[model samples]
Target: MNYSKKIFCQPLLWVIALFLISSGCQPKTEEQATAENRETDTESKLEPLTTENVVEVLTSYEKEHADSLVLISTRHGDIKLRLYSETPLHRANFVRLTKAGFYDQGEFYRVVKGFAVQGGDSDTRTMKNGAYKIPQEFNPKYIHKRGALAMARYGDERNPEKESSSHNFYIVQGEPKTVQELRAFEAKHNMKYTPQQIKLYTTIGGEPSLDQEYTVFGEVIEGMDVVDKISEEQVDGQNWPHTIVPHKIKTINQ
Candidate 1:
């Protein structure tokens, strides 16, 4: 009877020892799961604050407001501009700047005969002055035509490539349309225009050569006469008027 009892007790002791070993292993498993869960939570918390996420948000905003329009009031007159949906970056940049009242005190700094009128320099935004710059957004589809508004950049002399200044832009007016004139302009600039584009320029009249070279995000919608008036202004060597003409633009609904 004593031997049977000892045998039973020995097997029960082994079982108890195995149970303790298994219990100890379970704590490691639980610790590992807890660590993995913590890592997952940290990653989830860090996700949306990334730079890529911020840029995505801004890009989304630009897409939403692509077709917005703004009205430009000048001492000459008022011109309504329809911001193009195709050129999302340029459209959003312009809208953002205008809403910030960046152009409130800006003057038309550069004007040229039969070419364009330019403004939006940092020097233009002044109590005395305010300064800011935007990125260039050059789109080939939008051309410089009658009432076509585009950004102005320094000539390729220093820039070498026609890189645009974000703040400065121009309005193209009554430039003559001739094949020879087109050829001469293209040849002089070492640029090329498509046959269909050339045909459009000759008939419809535009600075087609300027397409894709500068950011053209908007066109004069209502007050093209105002653009014409400003385009016709007299200018000095710097392309600035002897009298400073103040131009103010306010954005309305698209």
Candidate 2:
């Protein structure tokens, strides 16, 4: 009777051990499954926003929503800008950069009183790094008028072909210049502004001479006061602000 009991107990123990091993090797717990599903969902959502996928997204965006207006929020004030559909490259580039947090923690490095407040250098993007350069997309039709957002570039002698620097951009703040002033600028650059362009300038108040010279991709939409504050800050010889009023730019919700 003792041997018979031992035999039965031995088979039962083996059966229990096999069951434990099988359960251990089965699918993960509900908590673990949920966590894995969440991770996958996050990755899938971020895939479209990644740098690799940005270009395609921007290209499609340009065709359907060229007249989209963007609002830039700053600590000091909000600035609104209308994106130009004509300059698809510049518009797309600006959108891509903004979404990537490229303007976070950036300083208004150059501020000319009653003229413009400039920022967006790679240096402004981060304390430790400088920004990358972008190709020039100058449309003579897009002029530098009050509140106009324009790219800053090195002089043609240095930049040759008037290519724009991707990192630096400025928002015009001064009163619009007259046609005579625009003509003088055109003469200096050996270019001409068209009649249609002149009409646009007369109505819109842009510096036509600056068209095709600098890339005008956007304009100030909301926070001119914040720009004024930065423009009015005291600065050193190197254009570094003595007081260093920090600024950040965020995209407006559509």
Best by lDDT: 1
What do the candidate models score in CA lDDT, each in turn? 0.56, 0.55
Q: What is the lDDT of residue 83 in candidate 2?
A: 77
- Residues 1-254, model 1: lDDT tens digits: 01111100111111233222211111112234334435444333122122124335436768676547888888888888888877665676566557656567566765665656666643323221111223456665566677787766533343445544434566766454899888887776466777876776787586655655566778887887776677677865444577776777677965
Candidate 2 off by > 4 Å: 1-67, 122-132, 176-179, 190-209
Q: CA shift at 144, candidate 1, in angstroms?
A: 1.5
Model 2: worst 10 consecutive residues (lDDT sum): 1-10
**Per-residue lDDT for 227 in model 2?**
75
| Best candidate (score: TM-score) | 1
Worst 10 residues of 1 by lDDT: 1-10
